[model samples]
Target: MMSTRLEPIQIGAPTGRLSDWVIAPMHFNGFAGLPTTRNESVKSPKFSCFGHQWRLLIYPGGDRESSDGCVALGLQNTTKESIEVETKFIIKHPHGGGDIRKGWDKVARLSPKGSAVVGDVGSARGYNNFALRSTLLDYLFDGALIVEVHMRTNKPGQQSAPFVPENPAFQNMLKDFGNEETADVKFEVGGTVESAKGRRKRAKTPTNTFYAHHYALRWNAPTLADMCKPGEVSPTTITNVRPEIFKHLLYYCYGGKIVEGDLQSDAKDIIEAADRFGIVSLKLEAEACYVDTVEVTLDNIVEIVTYADSKNLALLKEHCMDFLSSANKIEAAEKVSFDDIPSHLMKDLMVAFARREGEGSGNGDTLSSMRVSQLRKLAHEKGLSVDGSREMLIDAIKDDEEGGETES
Candidate 1:
């Protein structure tokens, strides 16, 4: 028989209400095959505990002649430094009453030179005869076993300082800086100028000018910093952007608050300008304002969802999907011209819709309710083929909906 010694499994840091810290659960699979000799031992991968690397060593058979029939377990400090910790080891009961053995706690001083052998440290009792080899098998769940370790510092708790809110005086000081008139850069933006008289185009483009300090622009907009070279002194012309949208972008750069009113009509333009100029915070704020203030209705859901996908705005996409997945709204969602929407977005929307339908609401089964011809039409609209049987077509539709490549 192969030695039942378990391979170490690495796990991520644990999460929960930690008195101090918890270790991710370690699982030992195929427990029945664990080595039954004194020479072999199962060890856990090194995990972070009390700011030091540590591993759990388990001798399924026994670690020595004295530990004949019982399993032996110990904690080893794997680093060069000494660590002091209060630790507990738990072996969950397989049939589900409680731990296989009552857990024991120990205040241990472990070092690179030696391990804190359970039940052996001064007055500290380890689970030496935790279980006999024959009886230990009963604690295995589905031929697997799990162990968890909890650790905390040996130090006394200290009092924490109280929290303080920001000062209003500091806010006033910042507002004064924003209103300063010593601007060093000028931006000339949007108005059509005559290009050629015969073509009925204006020869000179009409534009509005805004002023800002170069330092602020460079600090916030990297693209603007690249375009406005150091020591150069000429007004930079930014064409092809609406004057109002550019105004809002510059306002944000100047620390002016962007109210919902400013974004209601030009949210999309503001987001595009922010993205193009690499103003990440502004882009995020604009996306938030758009989602929070703008209404999602049949008329604009498609446009908004498409824009959200292009910008990778997860919150807006989720909102749009939730709106579209409502039972009363499915018909309106289907009316959307999904042709221009991204394939991935379409797939997500379809999957979400299918799940909602599958929940067995009064809306009859989604697949059975729709005619074969309608299903084919829907597939064809989504750039999928209609050349298969009804079941095959449904499967293909589901495959596409779930982001799988359509089988040829």
Candidate 2:
């Protein structure tokens, strides 16, 4: 049994969006007196997304730059004004298991079996906060970071709140970016807003107004807890293993950040950890490795076949069968092919057939010739008897059938 060596995979530029599922509420603690205020958001001045409620908020640079259960849509403006988004929404992340050949988008939607783990949750009130913070942050910060915005609703009369980029800091932040020219980036993508008097509300409104309660865009990178880690080792030791991979892992821990280059050997161990921890990108890298260089072993072959059988991975099972040709194990091959017997297994099955044939010949006196003929006929129909021997077996079976009829 040859040990399958997993090859190192080369990292490539991401083609699809990242997964950032909302798991918490995005709130501002120091908002004087609001129905939703958080102590954590005030002391350190950082907002969160989707934990108990779904939210989208601004990123205030700080040490504790990590949060659980919130999908991070990092600073991205691939197109003008529109921030690039990444998420692990229950309906989004590609659940390829360990298969690498599967495309990300193709695997994005969850099947019925996988739906429970990916259902939508969290609140829309927090969504309003996320939008406001993101728009305000976009106004204050350089183009360096984009705010996060949410798209799902967890309550009635609540939906994605658009960011208002026309506030005070909005101009100051634009000036810092050398845009000097003042412009308003409208926030309404879809849906309508009504005023307190039941009339239509415009984009600009008083802070005390319900429309002002809308959220801004905000995103964070992956954290230490999000990335792969060595077994029971301190984070410092992990950094020493490979500074770059460790840094990438740190970003993943904060949120998700994929650094390009050859992943270190220690990184491989961490990738394994990432798979266990539900880090999507790390699992993707591991799958790439399995596709690129992992050798198929007997145990792996069995696992692949079994899973393929269960999941209808016909191509994968076929590849496994081809790989097992040289092993020359009859029972194993039979299990994989369901007794169909690959050409490689043909010789083994043939030898067994010859032995059985010889035993039957020696026991000719134990059973009547008619019984043997009938057995040969059944074997011929199953392709178990020799080619062109069908006529002889049929003739014998016909004679036996006739003799039995006469006797009756």
Reference-based TM-score of each model: 0.40, 0.19
| Candidate 2: residue 262 Cα off by (Å) | 2.0
lDDT: worst 10-residue window of model 1: 9-18
Evaluate all candidate structures by whole-model CA lDDT and list the values in order.
0.65, 0.33
* Runs off by more than 4 Å, candidate 1: 1-181, 193-206, 328-334, 350-408
lDDT of 1 by residue, 161-235 (tens): 366876675355335442336566677787543221224333254677766666667867878766675445677
Query: What does candidate 2 score on TM?
Result: 0.19
Supply the TM-score for candidate 1: 0.40
